[model samples]
Target: MTTSATTETRTAAREEAEGHLRALVGSDDAVLRDDQWSAIEALAVDARRALVVQRTGWGKSAVYFVATLLLRSHGAGPTVIVSPLLALMRNQIAAAERAGIRAVTINSTNIEQWQPINDAINAGEVDVLLVSPERLNNPGFRDEVMPRLAATCGLLVVDEAHCISDWGHDFRPDYRRIRTLLDTLPTGIPVLATTATANARVTDDVAEQLGRDVLVLRGSLDRESLRLGVVRLKTAEMRLAWLADHLAEQPGSGIVYCLTVAATQEVAAYLRDRGHEVAAYSGQTDTTERQALEQALVDGRVKALIATSALGMGFDASLGFVINLGAPQSPVAYYQQVGRAGRGTDDATVVLLPQLEDRDIWAYFASLAFPPEQLVRQTLEVLGDAPGAMSTVALETYVELSRNRLETLLKVLDVDGAVRRVQGGWVATGQPWSYDAERYARVAEARQREQDAMLAYLDSTECRMRFLREQLDDPEAVDCGRCDNCGGLTLSTTVSDAAVAEAGEALSRPGVAIEPRKLWPTALANLGLDLKGKIATGPAAGRAIARLTDLGHGQALRALFRAGAEDGPVPDPLKSALLTVMKDWSRDWDERPVAIVGVESSTRPQLVGDLATGLSRVMQIPIVGRFAIVDPSIEPGRGAANSAQRVAAVQRRYDLMADVPAGPVLLVDDLVVSGWTLTVAGVALREAGASAVLPLTLGTQT
Candidate 1:
């Protein structure tokens, strides 16, 4: 790559890199492919930016690791790798060790190792250092650690580079921080960005962000080793039964991906009950627990790890299959998840069990898209006027965005130079920032197109793998002859009726605990509310008959909650389920409610009132009081949007509460979306001298 290098010099460097690659792969015959060597030369020798977009198993890691060693031998400093997943970091550390490269990672899981790792970086003893993109925004890292590293870094790598583009299926807000990182690195430092799932659009976006003269190397995105198929089922019970009856026949330990955390637990429990060894895993899984479960999958100690997207990206194992319990929201995401399998293997199965509720799940995620321009303007205005930096919680009181959405918005604003994150919290940079409504609308439209593509994948009769490749804009897309439609081997969907019945029982038997709010929301005084800090007395932890996301009862709940549904007494089946839930309540007789009360519902007053009446008649409890609307003009929809807004609406609505409930009370409501309504009502009841309040709701919207 160096114009002045002699032939001997280039050949020697090539040999050295190949030697390292052989050792990393544990095969003496393992040599770098031509494209891999090209990427390596562009970085290690030419000292230029390169973007590598290749299919999984194409040795992208080998390109960077080999380049790191080559650069080190030439007296360069350690390579800083911005990776996206903890599982990937773990796999990378082990892979680096095999290559005799001393790699260390700084992530959420290894907080205790940070000091030593930083020390090693200063000592020049570390060859490669791994970190998450989110870490780049951490005040300590951005202000203290990054400037030093950028000044000394030899090579910088951004793994899963597709995330840097909003067009990508996984366009994480944190990943946008990498653009700032690139701007800070020394001018001549070699930079490499890589991903296996990027389409032409994502590839161009990433390369443009990397800067001018970046060497773009995109190969065919096809995996011949993966045998893709779809198992269509009419109901959740049928799908669960299918998994129970056929999962044991899969070749080896693999992953079972679900869309939500609750579904992960339910499906995992059902499979375990059916005598398969499995574990439930999600982002909520503790750090230690995640490590153990990841190891179990790698070691084949468990048949499968039921998981959400948290377990995805860079988890390396000799996986023989990947089964999606339900379709992902997009084909690109589906390809990324299935890429976890069939690495270095001749054959691996990828199956999708498309659920009837997939579109509904897609709609739920769509609701969390970028907020309206008014909300964004509100957040910016709040930050601009604040005396000092405001924490995300404080911002939530001033703006209607939820915590997660607010945090994500802050990151985007930070990347756009409208705001900056400091040690304590966030401060506006006073830069004129224009809301790019057209850009956001384009992104939203892209996401919808991806969802439609996924739906097409589900119904396609051609090669399933080809459909995925086409979705990714792979020019080599063709029938692979290895899919179910192309005559690939597949499992049967003949589940026993008994298995279906068992799954039905598991799905329908529902009761999720509703943990009571302990402390009131912050900044209550700003809203002219007296509440602050911990409450002395409030509602006991309560229960819901079912979650609206429940696989068995969710469809029915959707029908009941859907706009324009008739409002009347609780349906007989739900009434029966409610009584059964009461019978199965964990509380003792002494903790039972002595009286019944109905919380006024503007949307479905009949549903809430009938619940209270039915409970009183069946249990013979006294009907003491009902909460009435004190301010009917209050916008109740705000109660479901943000904490401060919700508390205001709820407090205003329930100011006129009925008196004379002297004992534990059963407060009935149609649904609990945010719990602010229930919280305000319970606190008011306690202040009015009720002994205790317990909430019973028809559904939880989680």
Candidate 2:
């Protein structure tokens, strides 16, 4: 063919691609930026791996969607996107459909739809498929469906790719499964890794995983719309008061980020009490509720969604403001969350309210890091010598770790080839695996450094944006000339006395209901406990004077209950709080407790006795008697073990000491965790003919 004809054909193709991109964005005037085009060219034309690190609003989604359409036109197979969030998948699917590219997702919430989705993909009817990183570990998906998709995928895209790096603030173990996927991918298939927040270290880690000669496209990280500032509050109450006072003034709908799910609920309740339209979004939120909350934020129906990091990453709202109740431990996490705001506006407010507890929270999270070599080896030995594949639940019976911590360790082991997750459960891979002590130590060190950087950011007099950029290792870290420090703008730090008082009162108004354990824990039979199905007889729903993390009474309770805390009589103030709790409980009581029973404590016998005595005196109920230790040698503190072990331990430790009361009785304890203690005690009491057992405690450790 003539050179002129070939050139004309190529030019026409480019114009058509641009037109498709414009349609995808729903803007006739929409045009790709140079870097966006470069990413597209590298993915569709060059068929090479590429990483796009740009600000949130830089149209990263557009690049991938446009590339999907172009690749589909050339008859490349469906684009396989490993997205981190369900909200993001929904948004991407909607946007892809707008561009006439078919997209579907397979996630935990959409299990019933998986078969049809797989069928559609197999039939070449899907142009793009979005899957969560966790899905890569699913037995059926990994063993059956993923391989077929991987072999023919048009392009592989990792959204929020920073999560793949251990150095990332939001490192997810499931993301490591992507390395297996990458190793098995067909040659000549292009890959795209996109994120708005990855420092130089994370970038290097992710890029190395992508492949040799991967293209790295990083844009300036500055967001002119975000006006960054920090408001250091003296206490949680003051910080909450600040939010309640100033939330209404923020432009458009926004998010209020909290460090914990409990904190999210607390903040949301306080805000609602202060008359703000808000909802709490966190992992604990039901899937349907999460969808509703996401929609509420998008439609601007709510002022804000008080949330944990669960509400982050892939939530696409042109939020006008982002307020953090407590600072994230890492600057990258803070940057990613704040990036959610000001994406579609010229100006947006981003404020951080750093509290003293943020460091404690950070430390708590750090403690959940990769397990020690002993634990890792123990898990491996268990799997290696197992009779067969063991489900994570059953495996936990052999390991004395929380389900969360155990699952995390298992995922890490799965990546390291120490074990394999299959249809039945996990089996030892029989591959030699060495625990990387130095690597884990480095990760811990990196986390501490990030915490240090976050603290520095809170105290820095330099440009706030510049400080963040430097933390992310952005070369273009010049002062943004917009933050409070760079622009000489200081937000009002004063919180009203009335507001603080009200907040203090709200936080201190203790007594969160301790919902009774309705069912016996699963797999008790395996533990030789002879327990099966739900427990027919158990303690009635209970109440705690305060959670160990409560804002008001929580601090005192935590201090009193902390390890090494001296055992003593229940103090006068706590007695008053206990009285107040009962008073509150009386309002909703269906039956007056005729007696009080104390759970015997080996360490805090004095405290437990005092609390029970105090309640007995104030409520004028008979003292039924305290539970006696069946085995005095049995240690008092609950061990970190699975439910079966816990239940077995509780069963062997305590027994009813005296005749049961006929009427409802209040079963008092120093603290409640796992609910096994109360369960066994209540069962024994019921068997001994108590009408009902009402559990009340000074603190709960949920």
Candidate 3:
């Protein structure tokens, strides 16, 4: 055929595919909104592969659906969609079925499933065929399916295309070989890749790896309806209590993300005991059960779902909330999880409950980079023959690490191209043996550098939104105005003087003694044996009795210790310091206040419950006699005045806690950024009631 004739044929074929898409969707304009339509039109006009980078909930699927329909309508062969997850393929197939489109998927969930689908395509009956990337790299499947369908193949669509980029959060080694597939396809067959989230680096990587002339389309990342909040807890018990209370109040469709399968099971059980209709999904669960549970969630049989990171990638639900039970190791993960909630324009909540342990977990993983050559080599050798893929089972046979550790290591390898993924196994992409130690060392060093950068981003003290914007290379960035810190409602501040004075006055009552410990032995015991040991070793033996004499408690204890004093004199300074510390604490009640902000009103009860559970942590030993305060001033609203209200409200709440003798107050806020509101609230509490306040924010911004 002449060049012009071939061009005409290709144009005609694309137009036909567009028509088929409209017909399948049952409306000419069913798939694309105005902006989305513009994007599709641009893609169709340009024959090269293009990258569609949109925010979550922006209908990225519609772009490819429209393109497929256009091509199929023109008598093009079946459209092949390479997906990263079986759940995602099922989701798309389900949606297509609902729209009266003929779509089938080939994944492990269905045995011999692609056979019938392949037959249909050979007979020119199928319009769209969705398969996992692993399947695309399967020589047997490729040999059977591609040639039969090649004559009619219209467009190749790679969903969650970010997986093709090393910079992406969920990099898959198998995705790298997708470029080989593109190379094998007819030269004129255009490719289209779509992702909900990707930074500039990821976008570039996707284009490079796909080996296609690329066009880029990105939508706004801002989800104005989402209210972000962070909570910092001192212990695991406190985190559970927080989860229970938060789920209780929200009482809607949501997902609680845990870092491990064990954690997921534990949290789900805890929530269930608290009367939540909870479901759990983890890698440990059978695929069938997981599918049934996912369907139950979609059907509204479950009110809340607790899961590990395995659940979030391509799972879609219009949930009212998404709660992170622990801080994710990376912001990319954070954004992806939070994006699951607030799919609609209606206001929704994304709550992060960060504990010290969460940070430790991240730090631990960050420290695991730059593995020994043996470890890397073993990882590659295990991935042998697969060339770029490995099923969960296949991976287990090779790696000795726990599932979690192994997954992390595979993620690292996939990004580094030391190993690639294929159907049911991984393939060594670089030198399989230690043939080039120097080169391998250089590659390992580069990988470590990137990993370090990711860790630094996690540990940053800058605004989370600003940091993300910089990472994404978004030039027109502004303060998100919604995260814990940017909203100006942190609770980490000192209590006011007046509140502390009031607390002191209450404690100084004639009958009140400083040895409040004697008043509640059960409470003291519940403080844990660690505290008990600390007190016994440090102060309880010699100085505790004498210290009570300086405060009114000392006088009361002195009467009881008169015989001891007769036996042996106790030093005066230790006794005096105890009383002074108590008085100082009481005096600073208003000055140092703990502020707590709920991600949403629904989470207020959770904030309260977690605080109550963590009270011991705040009041024991190093933190004893400190104030425990909650500030509920930050609300989701626009404007500087609203921001000021958020700050003032936190201050006022701390001032209230400063007057209470619950212990030295710890400011509890959901999120922290610049620490300005926390500083203001601390100053206010000092001026109001607290002697001193320490700030405990859940997730630090940056």
Candidate 4:
């Protein structure tokens, strides 16, 4: 056919395809808005393979579905679809079936049973045949079925086209050779590739790999209806507590992502205990069980799902919320998880709970990429040879890499097409074997550079939206004003010294009775400190004592007594006297009570006097002899609050003032980050003369 004739033929074919699409959708008189129809129109008219780089929830499937219908109506032989995931293929097939269009999928699950599909395609009875790269590369498939079908196929569709570019987040080595396979067809078929996420570099890579003039369709990346919240926690217990509270407030179909199988199970159990209808899925679960659980989630039988990264590839449910309890290893993974929710254009929420330890995980993954060049080259070489076939085991052995490492490398190579797996082994067909090794090296290097850039972006202090835009080469990116960073919302790090001092002075009043150090051992004897050797008085003993003191249990003796006092009958005379002092102090401080107290000197008597004065001023009545005096020269035990001399003074004075009635007490400290020293001081004062002890800080670490 002449070029003009071919153009005319293609144009007529596209118009028919479009008409079929309109009929299939039952919207013949329906006029789609410009923003929505412009992309579809472009894809229909573009001569070279076109890539629709739109965002999620933008009707990308419609663009290709229409194209397929139009081509079929115009007498085009058949359209073969290359899908990355089997679940997505099933979804598309189901949609087509519902629309009364004849569509079928050939993948691992049913490739052996695909004779009918093959026969139909060969007989020109099929409209679209969806197949995976691995299936297309199958020796049996390539040798027996593809050649027959190739004669009639007209349009080739590559979904999630980013999987074909090394720069794409989820590259598959097998996808690279797709272009070569299309080239081998009897007719040079027009190709259409579509992906939800791709930056400029990935788009370029896609165009170059497909070896076609590319028409690009860009869409807004913002999901304005979604509310994004980030929580930082120091412990898993805290994370659980926060999650429980969040779920209580917003109950719906949500996903809780955990880092490991164990974590998934544990989190699921925890949520179940809190009365949530929770389900858990991990690689450890049997395929049957996983599928059942996924169905339950989709059917809304389960309110929430706690799962590992394995749950998302094939699942499509419009979740109300997605919570990442842990940071994912890559941005691709992060985006994919987030994309799970808000799939149907409804408002959704994505909560990111970043553990304090997540930074280490990021560092570890980042460290794995330093030597990825050799791995990338080798992967490409392996994949190039096989074109589209490779068994997991065979590929693993050929690369001489671990299964996991091989999978990651293959994903990257899939984009670059250094090689692609067929079914049992890899094939290399796109780039020349002798093609500049330097250029391949550059591609690998470029990927590494991109990864590094992504990592940097995640760690950045700028707005996540703006950063992502810039990464996509949008120079005019503006602040999203939605993400946590852009909203200028962060926890306060400042604590006033005056507040601490006021709390201290209020607690150190006279006439207030507080527990004494001599009685502490008795009070806390139930804590099993004796068995743990936490009560020893040697050098190590002092450290232990200091540690306990910092934990806000007062001195070692005070901590033990507090622990034991509640457990047994304590009729000690000193306890009685302390109780009396406390009663009197409470009565005296009924009005205009002091809120804080601070020790100004290292002398035990001076500290006691300071406490007595504050107590007396707050209480108005004096219950003298309520404070205990300790030797200032003695070094403070280990874990004691702050300096040994200062703690010793506070401890001695606290023991002497044991008979004083306690009021609200704030322990004043020079440094407050960690609050360890203040905690110890508060514990000591509560046992001595204060009813409640709060921390007063002069300064805190930023």
Backbone clash count for every predicted candidate, in the order shown: 0, 0, 92, 89
After superposition, candidate 4 runs with Cα above 4 Å error: 1-30, 33-47, 186-188, 283-287, 313-315, 330-333, 359-400, 403-463, 474-476, 485-702
CA lDDT of every candidate:
0.87, 0.85, 0.57, 0.56
- Candidate number achieving the greatest TM-score relative to the actual structure: 1
lDDT of 3 by residue, 634-670 (tens): 3322111222223334333433333433323454443
TM-score of each: 0.98, 0.95, 0.59, 0.59
* Among all candidates shown, the one with the greatest lDDT: 1
- Candidate 2 worst ten-residue window by lDDT: 1-10
Q: Write the residue-wise lDDT of candidate 2 on 1-702 in tens digits.
A: 112335565465567679888889888887777788878877877788999999888889988888888888888999999999988988888888988888999999889999999899889999999999999999888988999999999999999999999888889999998988999998888999999999888999999999856999998898889999988888878887898788888999999998888888888898899999999899999988898999989899999999988988988888999999888988888999999899889989999988766766677677788878887888899999989999887877667677888898999889888899987889999999988899989989998888888888988999999888888888988988888898745688888898899899888787888887777766767667787777788888888888775666877887898779998988777778888888888888778988888999988888988888878887787787777787877687544356766787787788889667777878889898777898888887777788888899998876
Predicted candidate 4 versus true structure: per-residue lDDT over 1-702, tens digit per residue: 122446576556545555655665577764444544544444444424677776566667777777666556556767788887655776788777765678888887765668877777667677788888866666687777777666667677888888887566666667876766767765345678887667788888887776755666666666554555566665445566666556644436878887656457666766676677888887778766876787787777888889887776536776788888777755555666777777764567777776544544454445444234565567566655653566554444344354555665554454444555454555665664333467557655765565566456556777766665566655456776766677743432223444334323322221212221221222122222222222221100001111111111112223233322332222243233333445544444433334544433332333234444544565464433322225544443322312222332344444433343455553332223233334345455555656554332222321
- Candidate 4 structure lDDT: 0.56
lDDT of 2: 0.85
Total clashing pairs in model 2: 0
* Higher-ranked by TM-score: 2 or 4: 2
C-alpha RMSD for every candidate? 1.5, 2.5, 19.5, 18.9
* Candidate 1 lDDT tens digits, 399-480: 8878888888899999999999997799999999998999999999999998988998888888888888888888889889
